[model samples]
Target: MTMTMTKLPRDLVEEILSRVPVKSIRAVRSTCKNWNLITKYERFANKHIDKATASERDKEFLVIAGDYLFSLNLNETHSRKFDLSINHRGISIAREHSDRTVFIAQAFLSQGLLLCVWRNVIDNRSRLLVWNPYWGKNKWIECPMTYCLYEWFAFGYDKSSGRHKILRFSSNNGDRYMEIYDLSSDSWRTLDAASDINTIKYMESGLSLKGNTYWYAIDYEKEDFNISLSSVKEEKLAVLFSPRDRFVIDIWVTNKTDPDAVSWSYFFKVETTQHLSGFLFENFLIDEEKKVIVIFDIYGGANNAYTISGETGHFRKVDLRQSPYKRPYRLVGCYIPSSVQI
Candidate 1:
């Protein structure tokens, strides 16, 4: 049977489109001329984009509940969870590696790609996989052993060279390195830019903005924190120190401002509950429309989740225990590479 667009009001259609995830909107627009015209409107598209982006910010938290990786949507009323077992009957790199037990160290969604790290159970070797969850397709790329040991890794786009790069530190030897993987050429190259930094011992966390990757680093003694920004095209690294002893810091690059001119000062920092403790800065949420940063804090003692906003430096407690889903065997949050985004 053919569908009729005449029955639905324009406002109602727009509202329904706004509620749908950004990934699905394009297909919906192709359904008919009315949708194509409505969705093509600059204002309408901007409205939906803003709504989707805001939803992504609030829904940044990732939890392994039951056998699924649950990512809360901005509405909180709705959520999208992917099965962790890798038997979901989809065209995913995760499914291709189903034979091997997968352990996700970090995951993030950016530019229509989900970048993640998975370990092979048999060989105990680590590999970086890029998957399109929406399309169910994935490609696995081998990560050097030197860069695999570090807990934090970030993958981002390089505008100048139009390549994808991964930045990670080698904790075993105190070596900070970056590996640039060219999707067009299907090859990887390591750069020596970050190798000279001695004081920036461990790469704590990272953020990707405007074709560059920004990392949070700590001194070997853990006395001070620093930030390093790398150019994907030039393969150059520049280091900057934080204004204070930022126990935990997270960076977010806003699209509203100039990509290159945007400075690190706009980033937000969260002071841990205790000084120099083991609290990890797992993930962060950036609300561009509201110009605020929401940070997720996971402590070892209670495994509780907290949020710190740029508007208020105070850390607010968030209740995750009340989630209806079953929790993972253990709750551990670590730095995830930018490549993994569902």
Candidate 2:
């Protein structure tokens, strides 16, 4: 039977495409040339990302387990692994311990892409690579050999300039050197953020919220209160503290944007009655709308996320099935899906 079908207007078609899931949109692009062009359009891609990110249910997480990459909905149970061999060639060395294996030493996610650090166990040849698994694209970046011994990497985007930068920090003797890599120029420049090696010796978790980057240190430093509260900006930094003396968790927030500013003040504290013994609290996420803080628990082989109420101070542990940590290595990051091509 022959039937006549009407084509959707370009604007209306794009609006409909922006509402569809990112994974499904990729599949439907091959339906027609117009659909393919619309899906690849930068404006349409940004629109879809904005809409998808606004809803928590449509979000997807990128998981790095062992040498594999997995993608899954945080609200669901199952995860599907992706073939990340797009840039795996010439980056790995043959290491024969019993047989041979390569591990994903470190990984960071920023603006819908992942920056990975791969280290060869046999030698000290380490490589930095960026991957956009959704689009099946990956590229290798030259690693700075000056701080190859000990260095930390962070990925963040600047909203004001729409540029992405990678922060690398390393220590030599007692002096710390900070380097910033600009993705726009594809170059690296040394930053003049003076720091005592002792001050940055211990850091627990790092998160990139909005356009700023923050690091939660294990050793809490005392800061002045009145000066930090002087800011009128709506955005602020909030730190969760779990002291070694008690089973109480403290939340501190500050509005000052200066790196050297002492603006943190106590917001609230949670006292847990449960036997949180032997349980290591690694990271946390704040759900401001729900007034709850989600805590990551890495104890034994049990991987759990505990949500504690801000008002009542009650908490419940969420079972996420598999342990985020495998042996001595663990992966942690938010699952944010977008249609923006890397």
Candidate 3:
């Protein structure tokens, strides 16, 4: 009753391993010579590398608080934190310029670049900074304004033009303006659009996906806000309406619930009560490979986080107060390809 490696086709085994998470595949590589050879194949390696990168992006959420930034690794029982504090030189410049600092402004991440904006204290100007934290390289561009400076802003990439655009709306004038920065040209130009008849309110927590930026908005009625999604590439807008009206919209990334498929479901909360809604819904990171969404909620002065499933919608809460390190406010998290890491 001896088992043979030839019993299973090599292609079949490769397919199975490709579907597994990269961590599991790494463990299997050491199991035997045949497994190691199969896992090390260039084709298999590239496929698994992409899968791992996408899984990380879908699973991790960058938490930005005050001066400190950290990455929250939610896969383990306790979350891991990585500090991203700028050096004294960078910190002093960031504090003096105001616009160079990364704050709670509209943030967009793509390729290896993170685009963010802050205010300039010396000139009272708004500036956009493009930086690659992974490589410690950054470039700053000043934004030109006509009247009052924008209180809220968003950063997005326009795929069609192959450039980045900054969308800012002024609360005082109820005007929304767009500035297109051609990364290749290193120039900026303003966009002309009809006035927004309705008062335009901006939400800081917007999600940028597929060259489009989506933000939560409250109508002039001062009631519940609706989800407003816009594409910088197309320069168009579309409204995504949820079933309930009183819900606070936060974006979640999950492949299990396809938007076009009949099984489409969104993970969010309807504010049933003031304090209770905050307790039930927590900001989380989605683990696509594990098929789980990890949520961290600081309630009752206790930092409790959990991971939920996209398919089953099951919840499990883990306490993190006992952990030595606490989650920082400003943190950067990214999923780099194994090839890139090497």
Error of 1 at 179 (Å): 4.6
Instruction: Tell me, by lDDT, which candidate is best.
Output: 2
TM-score of each: 0.54, 0.70, 0.54
Candidate 2 residue spans exceeding 4 A from truth: 1-6, 23-34, 59-63, 67-101, 132-136, 158-160, 172-177, 189-194, 201-205, 217-236, 253-267, 322-342
The Cα RMSD in angstroms, rounded to one decimal, for candidate 1 relative to the true structure is 9.1
What tens digits encode model 1's per-residue C-alpha lDDT throughout 1-342? 765556878888887776676546547777888887787666665667567655533223233433344443222112221111111221223334544276665554445455666655665566777764433456778776563345456666766766666655444465456666665566777766645434433333344444454444445555554333322112222232233454555444432424445443344454554443343333434333333433333445344444444444555455555454424312212112222222
Q: How many clashing pairs in candidate 2?
A: 1
Residues 90-133, candidate 3, lDDT per residue (tens digit)? 12113233343434354555544566656544444666776643
Q: Rate the local accuracy (lDDT) of all candidates.
A: 0.46, 0.56, 0.47
Any runs in candidate 3 off by more than 4 Å, and if so which? Answer: 1-60, 76-104, 120-125, 145-149, 174-176, 195-201, 219-275, 279-282, 298-304, 309-342
| Candidate 1 structure lDDT | 0.46
Q: How many steric clashes between backbone atoms does each model show?
A: 12, 1, 10
lDDT of 2: 0.56
The TM-score obtained by model 2 is 0.70
